[model samples]
Target: MPFALYLLALAVFVMGTSEFMLAGLLPAIAADLEVTVGTAGLLTSAFAAGMVVGAPATAAFARRWPPRLTLVACLFVFAGCHVAGALTPAFPILLATRVVAALANAGFLAVALSTATALVPPGRKGRALAVVLSGTTIATVAGVPAGALLGTGLGWRATFWAVALLCVPAAFGISRRPAGADDGSAPDLADEVRQLGSPRLVLALLLAALVNGGTFAAFTFLAPVATGVAGLGEAWIAVVLVLFGAGSFLGVVIAGRLSDRRPGLVIGVGGPLLAAGWSALALTAAHPAVFLTLALTQGGLSFAVGSTLITRVLYAATGAPTMGGAYATAALNAGAAAGPALAAAVLATGAGVTAPVWVAVALTAAALAVKFAPWWTGSRRPDPIKRPRL
Candidate 1:
């Protein structure tokens, strides 16, 4: 892989951290801002909704611009939003800043995936995308946990400041990177609409929502889950997050390799593991050992489900890589928003503590049952020789 690709990975890592760090800092934010915990949680919802809108909207607007340039602008916007978030005095101002930052994050991810695929050989595109996208997985291991610790030790504003500082150079690095190939033109609004119209693409995206929605529903509120339901406490949340990320990394690496070897097989295992992991998660607060065990198990299963889902969408989308794949990114953020929103609903009844794990169990089951009827005519040979990319 080109060194520029590693730069892409770094940018992704920072953005993922920026988007997710709020969760770790929610308690601090609630205390400092003097808001109810549920209201403070809207920050998460706002950012996620921004991504859901920004992914498609930005992709449409930037269709005529160079992908690299688009990515840089998005990164710059992301960094600036962090600064705004840090400086904002009122809760509403902070919420607004988070939304803008999330929009930038959505645009950045869509553009990054588009650029990564274009930068590689046709045969290795999947692997290239994996290499660059691994930053997200790495975030769980490093970014989210670190952000949690930073928020607890420094303050929520300090967390945003740190994210801003990290993103400044990432924007510069993106600007310096080489352009993606000119073989395929950037996708326009019409192209994106057409791609969304496809049944296959629809199923792929539905698969993303069904699987990821539940995962996020459970995991997005994880900090609270750890402390509230599991009775762990804020002092230890970061360390446990690191452990969750560790298991997640294992799943990502393994799934990437499996996609290269056999995409179909990966999907089959995805549904089963997703269910198993979340089932374990639902039982997490049942016991101390069970809580820790579920954290690791859910981490692995979620990654396996996510990686395979991305791979499946990319392989099936074929010609409309930018459009179809970008929608998947949108699904990801939308799913994130959905999970927490559902959690909030449960919290209103003072049932919030148990909401996440159970919601995750339901969503994972839905994901497993998403039954993509045999669309494949078994036309393509399952040749290990023409390996899927890294």
Candidate 2:
């Protein structure tokens, strides 16, 4: 791919890391802000909700701007949000900061992806996007863990500050890219909106929710799952998250490559592996090694299929890629927002942390049903999208 894609990918990494770092800092935020742990959790949800709404709202107006410049502007906004998030003293203020950050996150990913797609030949769009998006997958594996560790070892405030520092370099890198390397001239909004109205896009977005919900269910409560069900030492949860990240990073890389060749197969079957892993995790929590392996495998399988799904949406969107892309990000953020609460609800009822695994299996099976439904037929063709955070 071109140097442009890499730079956009790096900028995306910083944005993704900054947004998701809250997971690692939840406990600290609760204490610092004097809220319940559940309330701290809401912060993440609020941010995701912002993404879900902002993805389209931001993309709606971005059609007039060149893609690279749009991406750069978003990064600048992202950095500003992080700066506010790190320094804000009140919980409500932090929430506001996160909301702004989420909007920027949505814009950056959407633009970066739209640009990445244009940087390559039409036939190779999926593969090209995978390379740029690898940064996001890598963030899941590396950035989140490091942010968590920074909060644990140093302080939660330090964690946001560290991510903020990352944003500066990310914005600078993106700003230096060539002016029009990935800018396409097509007006994609109307076509993309029409595609979004299709059964395929709706089904795929639903699939994203279910798949992400399952992954989120198991992964979000990882700390408690390890301490309670698995009976593992608390010390190891951080290490396990990092290990899960490793699996996810590798999975994203492989999935991107696979999607370029066989997206339908990859997305159709991806949940099965994720379901199987989550099932194993719920059932074998007493077996520490098995539990960790299941977590790792789930990370790889669930995430690996994302680019394939995104590519399919993009291809289906035809002339309109931005809304198509924004829809995926919206779906993704909505799914992520749903995961923690869903899993927490299950665990709240004293079903143990495994309640979510059951939810995951059921949701995955439901997604499969829709994926193989009669109406979902007629589109074996590869598709495309615009930029939005995953």
Candidate 3:
């Protein structure tokens, strides 16, 4: 893999941290901004909504630009949003900044994936993408916790400042590095529409949504589940998140090695394992030790299945490579938004904190069914081996 790919990973890490750090700072934000916890949570929802809209929109608009230039511009905007967020004096302003920042984040990720995969050999796209996405897992391990700590010590605004400062280095690196052969062509709207029309591509995207939605539905409420259901303290929740992050990294590495050679097998096995992990979490949420163990395993399973899902999308949407990645990002973000909303509904109904676990199971099972659909198994839709460049 090219060194530029790792620089892309650093950019991803900055973006992911900005997104996930909100979970840790919600309480502080709620208190400082004098809003209800529920209202403060909308920051997360707003960011996800922006990402869903931004990916394809950004890809469509920046299609003519080089991928490196697109990525650098996105990072610059992303950093600027954080700086604005850090200086916001009111809740609404902060929320608006999140939306704008998320838009930049979505564009950066879509372009980064295209650039990273294009730098590698055809068979190694999975691993190359993995290298870029590992930044997210690493953020979960270091960034989220560090943000929470910074918020506690220096106020929540400090966390945003830190994210903004980090983006400087990421943007600088991306600007200086060559993005290989990826011209970062803006995707044609007509071509994307035609690509979306493919049943195989549609199914692949649905699978991505389901898996991500399932994983996040449960994960969105994990800290609460740890404290309320499992009887662990706040500190322990951090440790468990670190463990989950470790599991995610492990899954990405393993899936990277297998997705190229055995996309079908990877999904077939990973989908069920993810479902099983959720089922076990549902059954054992009251047991701290058991819940922690299952959370770790579940995190890994989610990403492993995710790696294969992206590979599937690239295979199915061969006609529109950049649009395929943007679509995948959009699908996953849609799931991310939906999962928590549905899980919140379950919570509102007094279904207990463990309800998210069952939500996860159902979503993952739905994904498993989609993966095994007749259309997916037919001879006419055989998985193709040839890959696209950025």
Best by lDDT: 3
Question: What lDDT score goes with residue 357 in model 2?
Answer: 77
Clashes in candidate 2: how many? Answer: 13
lDDT of 2 by residue, 1-390 (tens): 787777777777777677767776888899988999988887887788888888888878876677766777787787777778778889898888888888978977776666677667766777777777778767777888878878889889887777777777766776776745445465646666777677656776887777777777767777777888788897888777877777877777787777766775687677677667777787888889888887788778877775677776666554665566677777777777787677778778888667877777766777677777665565534334532211
Each model's RMSD to truth, in Å?
3.4, 3.5, 2.2
> Which stretches of model 2 miss by more than 4 angstroms?
179-188, 378-390
lDDT of 1 by residue, 1-390 (tens): 777777888999998887767766788888888898889988877887898998878877776677777888888888888888888778999999888888888888887776776677656555766777788878878898788778878788888898889887877887876676434365456765776665556666777777778777777666776787677867757766776777777777777676645766766766777777666666657565777777777777787767767766665556565665578788877777787677667767776477766777777676656554443323233534454421
**Residue 195 lDDT, candidate 1, scale 0-100:** 69
How much is 221 displaced in model 1, in angstroms?
3.8
Show pairs that collide, candidate 1.
127-390, 217-339
Candidate 3 lDDT by residue in tens digits, 1-390: 788888988988889988998988998899988999989999999999999999988977787788878898999999999999889789999999999898999998887776676788778878888899899989998989999999999999999999999999888988887668555454576876699988778888899898889888988888888999899998898988898888988888898888877876778777888898888888888998898898788889999998778777776776886676688789889998999899999889999888988999999999887767676566344435544311
**What TM-scores do the predictions have?**
0.88, 0.91, 0.95
Instruction: Please give the RMSD of candidate 2 to the true structure.
Output: 3.5
Per-prediction backbone clash count: 2, 13, 3
Q: Considering summed lDDT, which 10 consecutive residues are worst modelled in model 3?
A: 381-390
True-structure lDDT of candidate 3: 0.85
The true-versus-predicted C-alpha distance at residue 263 of model 1, in Å, is: 1.9
Q: What is the Cα-based TM-score of model 1?
A: 0.88
